[model samples]
Target: MKTCKEKALEWGISDRSVNNMCKTGKIPGVMKEKGVWKIPDDASRPVDKRVTSGKYIKRELQEEIKPLPIGISDYVRAQSEYYYVDKTLLIKEFLDQKPLVSLFTRPRRFGKTLNMDMLRVFFEISEENTAKYFVDKKIWRCGAEYRAHQGKYPVIFLTFKDVKFDTWEATLDKIRGLLQEEYGRHRELLTSDRLVEYEKEYFLKILNGNAGEVELTASLERLSKMLCTYYNRAPIIIIDEYDTPIQEGYSKDFYEEIIGFMRNFFSGAFKDNKNLSYGFLTGILRIAQESIFSGLNNLTVNSVMDEEYDNYFGFTETEVQALLEYYKVSEKKKELREWYDGYLFGNEDIYNPWSVINYISRGCIPQAYWVNTGKNEILEDVLKIATDDITEKLYSLLQGEKVVARIDQNVVYRSIAEDPANIYSLLLVAGYLKTPKKELQMDGSYLCEVSIPNREIAAVYKTEILSHLLQIGAITRTTANKIAESLFANDHSKLQKAIGEYMDKSISFYDAGAEGFYHGLVLGLIALMDNQYKITSNRESGDGRYDISMFPREARYPGIIMELKWQKDMDIESLDVLADEALDQIDDRRYDADMKNDGMKDILKFGIAFSGKRVSVKTNR
Candidate 1:
């Protein structure tokens, strides 16, 4: 027999993939012995459904479909070699607006880098007549008025998307390296007669990576001036993922240092610099409150809430439909929409381009493809300061309910912990929540109703968000699994024991006396059963509202209803009576009516009481 690791190596797949295949019976003669998967040595790799089902096989003479650009951010290569979506119209929009300096704030992996590169390829003077890249695109048909600007100016492009470091010193070094590379791109400046000896000396210093922090901070302004002097036209500057280093600083305990450096650095490049023709920046958050763009009055900010360039950053429904049609998988459109669609960028309904590409590339198996792309630090930060009210609202959102919130476009990372309400603002910009309805407030904020975007985000919430909350209390995974097993088995005694153990270990005495606390605790734990049950809380059933309800998604699993009660200074006997009272309340109010109406025959009603750290659970099995 061979282990899963051996099979993974032979199949050129991950070990986890091999184990999952065994668990799902995708491979024959696989067995688990002592928690280790054993597979037959001669077992063949499973045939991919996309290949065998004739979905990708051509029976007659037909053009083969081009590969999707999964993570390609290089515009020249992506447009030439892959199934490039026509985003060249972004150039037309920019030419029409002609903003002096534009900052686009979008979530990660939404084609920010690619769009920026597209702009770079369009405007930057190249010897290869880069206009050919856009000749077949939508922008080319817009007439020569837009095409006249192609390859007209020198462009200074730098992407800080990968400059993630744990220390200010290392971050500075990475920045220096990036500047050195940008300087290397414009090597003509070293020999240009337009630049004086002193300017060339500074240029050489930056190009050779021997520049200090002061020189590096002044690098953009210097390079733009030299390029302008040589080309007799002001240079355009593009910075991709500009806030990556800033986010790293905030998370890595070097916020002030990075913020201070960025202030001077951005000021030199953009603030009152006549050498700059047009500047562009893209990041997840605006970070305006950090003073990074201070005193740049000419700067125009286009966020997800803005209507000017909404559809440019992400894939629209039409683009996705066309892509699906081209791939001959138009039937998967509904499933793709459920998993990857539902993002609202202004009035345009957008889908995550990254996840959509990944879904199609991976045989249309729907999962949280976008969630795995980056760390969900924004959600983690929000959960750390979550109040009881915030917790309840989050639980409601997880259960597919909408809640109203005020979204401030200028929200910063440092201010998130000070005001928990800013969590919604962060969540919206970071693409965790979507605003279906919004009204502009007088203070430049939006009063919006926000909810989880789609099924993929709901799954991410139940797993990442809930798991992080449990981890904060040092709760073991075994404890969670035990609770889920006990509840599913209808073993009220085991469930009661599990609840008591969790409360005893995780809850503080000061936090246990409130009924709302217990409600939140139980709701968080029950949220883990999302795969099997459609979890709901504080929803009206038949006659009244139930505290928590688990309507099983399948008829095989029993429906669950939990009624919680808490009182201060209650002894064990009083707690027991309170538990029974809770059970009576559930029955009297007919909280199980909705479950019964839905044809759920096996219902387990749990009445849970709490006083201080003690818990009593009584159930009508």
Candidate 2:
């Protein structure tokens, strides 16, 4: 055995590194004597991992991939600690077009916050010269004209991402706290001779966080002036997720109060402030111009349909392909595309960045990562008061059908529930729907043919619609569970009784047609067992099209086939006879033949008859 110093000399590394390895047990068969490490002569060098070299360790270990970043918006940490997809070029694109005030509206978790941070780091005139963060990134090669803007201006970056609150008072308090924090970053200005006495008083009030409502309302405009005084240059402003508070206010009962304050608050800083060089804002929806950007004429809004900066927010196919190739999971690309791809930003195809990172970092198991982040409050709210026609359209979307509507990109939140097209517009901007094809009408309106973007978003609609049914008492979890249990146990009477009761409660939307309504009801009920059953509908099997088929992904569970007939003229007494005839039709058509071919040994068939709110069920095993 030898001291760590001897091993360091032999391995041509620092003695401290060897001592650290010994202390952390990375070096095997080493012991400590007194205050020093004694290393075994036969100890081979462990691979150095102290510095990230754009390559991870071998894929055979328990942690084959680097840790996935969650809720991390710092560009430096994200690039250093994890496998980062380079979105730094977003900075270059912003510099190239340098809009006076640019507002980008994209759904949450689409790298908006992180991209904002990248802009702050690139543009803020700091003494540290943070160009090291973008050393080898794509933005570094966009030519010197673009690179010259790096660290060239004073920047005031603030994110209203967490300003969502249930009350106006609480929301105001949070904004005051954020302003105080930003002021603390420049507290050194308090002693500068450049600041006049009155300006100093206002700065001190904001810095101490004891400002009145009037002062707090004008905080951003005041801070911009102060920053200009201190730096001798106007500062660029970046506000991220700017509409979170407005959306929350509308959901809660304080929309007018919040809007009144915000209209003045934004107009003060952005409308005609000479201290402001430019501004940037990002959110999920563009609250109407008259509502928020009341008098800001220089503002530019780039929504999902805009061609400028289309590839900046989400992952393009080329970017996703590069990431998959780096992780050596190229074969999983098709599955990832099916789940996370299909978002259309401008004319470019985009994938959800959050879902893609999680899928690769979690061993490539495809899941609805983006959908499970937060409650779909906005979507549920829209569904609560949706008209019958809108409800039918939602059901069609779940069935992989396309919905066409004239979408107004600038949404008026207060009046969204009044128009069905507004609901489709909300879903489109909120990242739930995507247009695979569109046409420009002669009247200057876009005829967009939209559908659920991908499987992940489809799962979101399924979960939310199921919850809506439960909330309205159209169905109950106990009844759903009972149905699954009875189907598995071949308890025909119990399952039949539950279906009749559920149908009776869910008959309000039958104007679309009895067959379609009953079909949607049964489909929603079966979706509850989606984990165990791969349910399909209106597909060719044997010699005819079956209404619904629940084929167990696991062969252990029995296959289920359901046939339904709606009678407009039958009395309640003859419903049983109609149900028996439906059963005979299922047998005559050999609906079970497909299940048999698929190697399902146990099969259960159900025939259901519906008349108004009454239902009859008969089964064969």
lDDT of 1 by residue, 186-302 (tens): 998888887899998998898788999888889998899999999999999999999999999999999999999899989989999999999999999998888999999999999
On residues 1-621, what C-alpha lDDT tens digit does candidate 2 reach at each position?
877756654454556667778878998888878877887767898886675444443422323344656778898777655667788777777777888899999989999999998899888888796876675578877888888888888888889999989999999899889989988887877988998999889988988889977888798898899889888889898899988988889888888888888888888889989998889999998876446787778998888888888999989999999889877899999999999999999898999999998898889998899989988986787777676467666766776778787777766676666665578878888999998877776764467999999999989887898788888777877777777776677666676676656666666434435687677677766456655676777788888998888777776777888999997867867988998988887889988888999888888788888887677778878
State the local distance difference test value for candidate 1.
0.86
Write down the RMSD of all candidates, one decimal each. 12.9, 8.1
**Which residue pairs clash in candidate 1?**
none
- Candidate 1: list runs displaced more than 4 Å: 1-63, 483-505, 508-513, 539-546, 569-571, 588-601
Q: Give the top-scoring candidate (lDDT).
A: 1
**Weakest ten-residue segment in model 2 by summed lDDT:** 56-65
Error of 2 at 426 (Å): 1.0
> Per-candidate TM vs. native?
0.86, 0.78
Worst 10-residue lDDT window, candidate 1: 55-64
